[model samples]
Target: MTESPAHTLFSFGTLMDERVQTALFGRAVPTSPASLAGYTTRPLQITDPAVIAASGLDVHLILERRLGASVEGAVLHLTDRELAAADAYEVDDYTRRRVVLTSGESTWAYLDAKPLRPAERIVVVGDSIAYGRCDPQGGWAARLAAAHIAGNEARRRVFNLAIPGSTLADVSEQTPALLPARRPDTLLVAAGINDSAVPVGAGDGDVRPDPAHVDAGLDSLAATALRHGARLVVAGPTWLDEDRTRDYEGLRFTRARALALRASLRCWCEANHIDYLDMWEPLRGNGGLLADGLHPTAEGHRELYRHVRAVSC
Candidate 1:
């Protein structure tokens, strides 16, 4: 029998993000907002940070439509070796299931489902970094994906939906519809700096610190992930240098607050059975790790992958 040609992988998450696409695929991908029917999208909880998902609630199968919608994403035409490499990057907590895409024809695609654990799908949601900013290959979310794939060959798939400037309030607002659609396995949440920096309180236009709001948002995200048989991983914010002296009303980016915020997130993760990754401490020492003051460099990504590999091993 003649061998069939390799199939193309359609994505709608972090892989869709520009930088991440370039890093993993060695170039940009052509994409559109493809929607899968009988599913919904949700905010993913990954310790201290949030991601997004497209899950199915009522049915086991997810029917997708490549509507040519102008969403950001890419199409990767894979060879067996490339597929293997991709699989190596998505092994943990995910299984490669083929789905029928709604492009007026049936197309095989990969879906990340954790049947053994029966956990919620893993979603990585947040701001720019979550969106695979500056250092495409080095973003924590991508690193996590690559690590998971390498460790759990048969079951690792993650959907990363990190928008720039996304906040806790945004997550709270977007979660309901997304959860049922994505049916996530876990949620990885990393957001806050923007919220903290925005001015919105009664005072001399001062920035506010509403840990309660942040906590509530996280709680909801966790609950949603758990509801869909998913776990949670909350990652705290990485260090950023927003001039505190400028007294930027509503935006507070200070080292002290960052540490405290991370602690609070860690406490929440522990109590909720969510995994926690401390990006702040690990990425601090060398300037080599950060592309700018905020994002991770290629070396930084490698370091993160090493840590994740260690954990899995």
Candidate 2:
């Protein structure tokens, strides 16, 4: 009989590899998504021949202390014996340290044996589009995050905080809470479609969000990001297939309204000296890119990802 795995290990590096885990523990350990805040990763060159062969790499990720940053990884459950095996596998350039995960779980991890500094972080906040919606791949934001995972030397951490059915007002209310904990180098606000949507059967009273309030919300978000040393980029409203979108979840979207909002948001971004991503033009006349007339399909998300990657770079 074997005792239940009692040790908790958080890994933001090669220990995440199934091959590495099997070599050390004789099996792949159980793990769950988790993140460590106030830390980042840098490349650590490996000289140990055994580690190089075991992990199939001559370089590995090493943690570095950085304020206003976080590293995404997983929490691995291991028995005491397996934990010891992991310790033996790590080289002198790595040091084991007990740390608290963002979920408040206390776990042991291998951090940089030597101290250093540096990094870039991106945070995306918006509506369902930014939240990925119909896309099974988790949309453009997830693609951006995947691009930076593990082996990528340009490693940029992207955090998507968008929610379905969110509006500028909702983002304005939620974004402030992200501060003091996450100070992203770039902040992407991908919203306004919901704001432009007019409620069905409401006649003339069914109006798009007031330009004044929209401007105020944008200004507030920009100020918040700027104060925290982040560059703000606003992704304007996308084009809608009005023919298929006139009735959506008790609301109605029109081509004219979407176009108006896009133009208004673009002008505001320009006047405010903020970067604006013109999501409307590329998506217009392409109803196939939209699912159910609103949210993007998988191919549509890839299209969106290309535009986002351009500005982010």
Candidate 3:
């Protein structure tokens, strides 16, 4: 099996913009002409401000036809960083997926698939962030759900059982009630911010529910999800914006505490063969999306949706 470049994109569109290529990759990349079998392309409107500014265009190609013909494009070599940047630039109109070119080359391409027609029963179990509290429109979950529905019109039932201040234990406690056992759902969890909190007086040394206990709870959550015949995924707790958290929300946990908790939660997910998304890295330093450094604002929810798409969809 051949490994794809850390990143690869078969661009039938956008990267065609010189400014977009420059802004997204910092330089023009060498490309080879390629054609993808079984797809058709049409114009897709670009709505993201930054993407519009970078591309200097409001429309790009959207591929819909998936059989009997081909779509001509180019194979672009992108650094992982650049690939992520391109993902951000594409916004939600398109999603990247691997494709095999007629020339026998395998690469990635952006496609606007169909929409919702529920196939998998996906259940999200965790905290307030999962509930999209501060995100005016909807949290990442909502955004991801909409996109999932669009991608194939695949009908999906996503049970969002998120609670404010939910510790891993709280999540474990709620699992049986929210998730169906025999039917089996695709379960996702994002908790631990509550357990990792240092509080105003506790400083950063230790948290309320022991971190070990948090891990134990996470383990239990995964076990229960699997026992009930559901697939499990997790978005580990994100890092905080100290100033925003302190000034706005008045929550004062340190970076060290966040890192420690993230490490613990991530380790548990990896060990259990659970699909995981590291929430902190993507959301960090992003201002407009964060309402108070801790929770996502409306735009933040959209941004989270993008990240969620890359990992889950």
TM-score of 3: 0.58
Kindly list the per-residue Cα lDDT of model 2 for residues 1-313, writing each as its tens digit. 9768998999987889998899888999999899987777888889999999999999898876466679999999999999889989999876565566777666778854421112256788999989999999999778877774433444556688999988888898889888657667567899888888777976645344588978988988987775564556788887778778757689887777777778778888868656677877667789999998877899888987786655434
Please list all clashing residue pairs in model 2, or write none if there are none: none
Best by lDDT: 2
Worst 10 residues of 2 by lDDT: 111-120
Candidate 2 Cα outliers beyond 4 Å, as residue runs:
1-119, 150-155, 204-208
- RMSD values, in order shown: 17.9, 17.2, 11.5
Q: Runs in model 1 with CA error above 4 Å?
A: 1-121, 150-155, 198-208, 241-252
lDDT, each prediction = 0.54, 0.77, 0.68
Candidate that would win on TM-score: 2
Each candidate structure's TM-score, on Cα atoms with residue i matched to residue i, is 0.52, 0.60, 0.58
Residue-wise lDDT of candidate 1 within 231-287, one digit each (tens)?
455667675543322343344355555666677777776665456666665666566
Give the distance in Å from residue 196's predicted Cα in candidate 2 to where it truly belongs: 0.4
In candidate 2, how many Å is residue 218 off?
0.4
Worst 10-residue stretch by lDDT in candidate 1?
48-57
